[model samples]
Structures are given as C-alpha cells and as structure tokens.
Target: MRWVFLVLIVLNALYFVWEQQQPSVHVQQLPSVLNPAGVANIEVANATNSQTKTLDSVQAKINLTLLLGGFSDPALIDSLSQRLLSLDIDVKEVVVEEVDGVDYWVYMPPLVSRSVAVRQLKELKARQIQAYLINQGDMQNGISLSMLDTMDMAKDLVQKLANLGYTAEIKEVERKQKTYWLAVNSRSERLIDESLMTELTSDFPLMRYRQEMPQ
Candidate 1:
C-alpha cells in the first residue's frame, strides 16, 4: 500500500511538470500598425520545411529625401533621425547637403515625392512641406529675412506687392527657429523699396523675406 501511494504521488508530480512545459494557449499581443481600429490575429503552423516565419508581414519600404532648409540645429537632426528609426520602416541613408543658401537633408528611401516624405514626417510630429529650388543663380542677388508670425502678414505682403503691379508671388512659407521665411517672386527689374519692405517687416515682425527670382 505504501509503495502504491508513493508511485501515485510521483505520477501526479510528473503530470504537473509536463503540463507546465506545454505551449500556452493565450494569444500574444502585438504592436498596433497604421490603423488604430484594426487588430491583427496571428496563427502559427509547423511546416516540413524548417524555415522561420515572421509574425508581421514585411511592408514595402519608402524612399524619402528631407530638406532641412536654413534650420541648422544638430539636436533637430538627431531627434528627427531617431524618430524615423523608431518606426517600423528602415532608413536606407541620410545625406546632408547645402545647396544655394539653404541647408538640406536628403534621404533616399523607396518614397517618390516630398508629399510622401511629409506624411512620414508627420508621424514624427513635424508637419511641414519643404521644397528645393533647382535654380541657385536666381536666389543670388537678394537680402533674405528668416521668420513670419502669421499667414495674414504673408498674404498682406504679397497683396501690397501686387497693388504696386509688381506681380509678386508667395512661393512657400516656412518656420525656422521661431521665425518664418516667406519665398517670394517678382520681376527682376522691379526692386522692392526699403520703405515698403520696412512697412511689411514692421507689420510682420517674425517674417523672414526671400526672393525666388524667375528662371
């Protein structure tokens, strides 16, 4: 009777150990993808071929080029790079170049245009569209300002130039280091007077002015 009881206790202990070693039935949680409402369900299967299968599907990598503009803060670059790396996507290469008067960071990924780059940039909490001017010669002869306070001020400056029949165009508006740079266009001969420029500047203290001369 004593031997039978000992044998039963040993069998129960072995059964408990085997149960602990079995695969868990509880599902493993995964990180959320692009969509918040969607949840992914994973199923594992053993195959005769001993190849490892990943839980998440590999997405097509995007190619993007980042233009940093006049903003030359090293902290900004590191922050941006780290944020990009944190995403599920892979960064191929980041090239820093200075073309004409502006600083640029060119990223070569599998992405097509700046719009796509901006979308990815939005994920990192920076949402601004940056453009590279191809013709550097056009930007040579000018005094450029560095920041703008409001869109209304930008519109006002453009309107004032238009009123003078100078045909000014606002190419782009960018904010850098708490200042705004407004890219403007007008005929090369029609020079902006100091008084008018001063008026525009006073009204929009934060505005930086730059001319994008016609090519």
Candidate 2:
C-alpha cells in the first residue's frame, strides 16, 4: 500500500512538470487606425482645418463701397450726377450738410434792407474800397470784405478799410456751407467701375475717391 501511494505521488509530480513545459496561450492583438483619444483629436483637428479654410476664403473676398467728392455747388453736383449716369453708375442722393462759417463784410452800420446793402457796396466802391456785394444768401446786401479763412486776414482787410476812413465789421455768418460727396456701393466687386472712376477723376480735379467696407 505504501509503494502504491509513492507511485501515485510520483505520477502527480510528473504531470505537474509536463503542464509547466506546455506553451503559454497568446492573445491576438488587432491593429487599430487610432485610439479612443487619438480618434477624437484627429476629428477635432480636421474640423478646425475646414473652418480655418472657410474663414480664409471669406476674408480674401472683397465687397467695395466708394466715397466720392463733397462739393458746395449744386450745379457742379448736378453735372456730376448726369456724368455718372452717362457712365451707367447708380449715383446716390446729394448729402447736404450746413456748416457754421464766417462771411466777412465791409459795410456801414444798419444794413437794414437788400437795397441798403447794395447801396452800401456802391458807396464803398466809390471810395475805391475793393469789395463786392454778398449775393444769394443771408449777407446778400452787405459789401463782402473778403472770404478769407483766418481772422488775421479778415483783420488786415478791416485795417485797409479803416485806412480808407470806413468801418467794416467781420460778420460771423453761419449760413454758407460746403462739400458734396458721392457714396456708392458696387453690388458686385467682380465688375468694378474703374473706367467710370477714372472719368470722374478726370472731370473733377478736386474729386476724392475712397474705398470702404460694403454698406
């Protein structure tokens, strides 16, 4: 019985040795294009690139709006409108803005009426005072000293009148206004009116052209 038990133990030990000698089972790992986070990052990068390209395209494109000269002359503006129409440009309306300015006058006191103003101008001319009648507006009758920009020039004219033994007051006339600009937005930038603009520039020597964003 002891021999039998010894034989059984020897067999179990041999079986354990055989099991240890056997090859380990290997798991087959499939190749993947991207991991979970890697896949998300790649998708995000692709989306960002597409959005950037779209924004670049929009930024590169242009929609033009033009601003032209500001003129005080109605006749000149009317002429410009007609000329622009001739060029097939859809001209916008004239933007009339009244600016405060001084119209210096070399007239005697109490320029009560238009006749008085005219008579005053004549009297000043008779004295050889180089002056003209301010016509068409508020100072219509007053003898125009000079349409000077600075007060120094106006004072100089007043001094000259004083030399001629006459008093001329510098009137702060706010009625006289200036500048007419043509603002237009081209419906399509692909068809730019370069020739028309050139023609306009040629016509008005003082005309200013400015390009801005679409209105």
Candidate 3:
C-alpha cells in the first residue's frame, strides 16, 4: 500500500513538469479593417481636396481674354454684336483711335476783309479755278483752294496758283479714324471656329480682324 501511494505522487509531479514545458496560448488584439469614424474622415478630406482642385482649374480658364479688332463701320459693329448675342457668346465693345491717313489743305491766308475775300473768290471762279470761301474759324475771310491727298499734289496746285499770280499755302491735317473691337472671354474663343469665321466674313465683307491680349 505505501509503494502505491509513492507511485501516485511521482505521477502528479511528472504531469506538472509536462504542463510547464508546453507553449503559451496568448490572445492578441488585431486592428479593425472597417472603422466607420476613421473611414468617414479620410473620405471627406479626399473629396474636399479634389473639389478644390477642380474649382482652381475652372477659375484659371475664366481669367483669360481674347480680342478681335479692325472693324471700321459702326453699323457693321452693331450687327456683329447682335450675331454674337444670338449665339450666346459674351462680347464687349472697345474703340481704339487710329491714324487713317494725312490730308493736305491748300488755301490762301485770311484776307484784309470779308469783301476782299469774296472778290478774290469771284476772281477764282471767273478763271475756272475751284475755291471755297472761309466763313468761320481762324481762317475766316480766307479762301480754300482744295484738299489734296498727297503733298506732291498740293505743291503742284500751289505752283499753278502762283503762276496765276495767287498766293496759296499748304496745311497738313491728320485724319483720325475710330477702330471697333469685340472683346471676348478666352473660353468663348472655341465657339468662333473656321466655319463661324467664314459665315461672319460672308455677312460682313469689310470686316478685318486680328487677335490680341486684353489691355
């Protein structure tokens, strides 16, 4: 009976040693793959950044300008504006002062009196020389011989008048003309393609244009 009890105690001690040698079963916590709060914040931030980029791109496109110029006639400018309006294109009118050409005026200086001017005008008419009596301004009581396009023509007329025993002077006058332009946004430039340009030219045969940046 004593030997049986000793054998039981030995079996218990061996079982304890075996349990100590076995590997530990520890439980580790893992990260969640579908965290609602974290996912919502990240998605909202990405969407906001994308939307801001798109708005900036559109703003850059809107700031550019296009200019179409060289329209001389007011009536033609009006028609073109109406045509652009019909096509839903925004346009603004711009006028630029340009020097068209020079004109030379041949005339006689103001005479001593109005009676003297009239007498000289009559003498010119009797001699078959066209003349105009100056009625007002600084040249009052003077006689205008003619307005010639070229300086050479004016000098020739002055020599002819001198041969006829008449004094004539030449005055240079600058001829200014107003040029009309249609200002459009760069975004609208795509709408004015070759076909549209051809149609516009057919409608306005005298319309000449050049493109430039906005001032």
Worst 10 residues of 1 by lDDT: 57-66
lDDT of 2 by residue, 1-215 (tens): 99999999999999999999999999999866667898899999999999999988676454546667777666777787777667566667546465666655444444678787777778777887677766656555556656666678788888888887777787555555767766564652233367766877888877766665545
Against the correct fold, how does model 3 do in TM-score? 0.55
Top candidate on lDDT is: 3
- Candidate 3: list runs displaced more than 4 Å: 1-66, 95-97, 185-206, 210-215
Q: Report every candidate's CA lDDT.
A: 0.38, 0.69, 0.88
Q: Please, what are the lDDT tens digits per residue for candidate 1 over residues 112-213?
A: 444654444443233222322222244422212222355566566556545644233344433234321222222211234566457545654433333232
Question: Can you give the TM-score per candidate against the true fold?
Answer: 0.21, 0.40, 0.55
- Candidate 1 global lDDT: 0.38
Off by over 4 Å in 1: 1-54, 57-136, 141-147, 176-215
Error of 1 at 152 (Å): 1.7
Residue 42, model 3: lDDT of 97
Q: Candidate 1, residue 86: CA error in Å?
A: 24
By lDDT, highest first, what's the ranking? 3, 2, 1
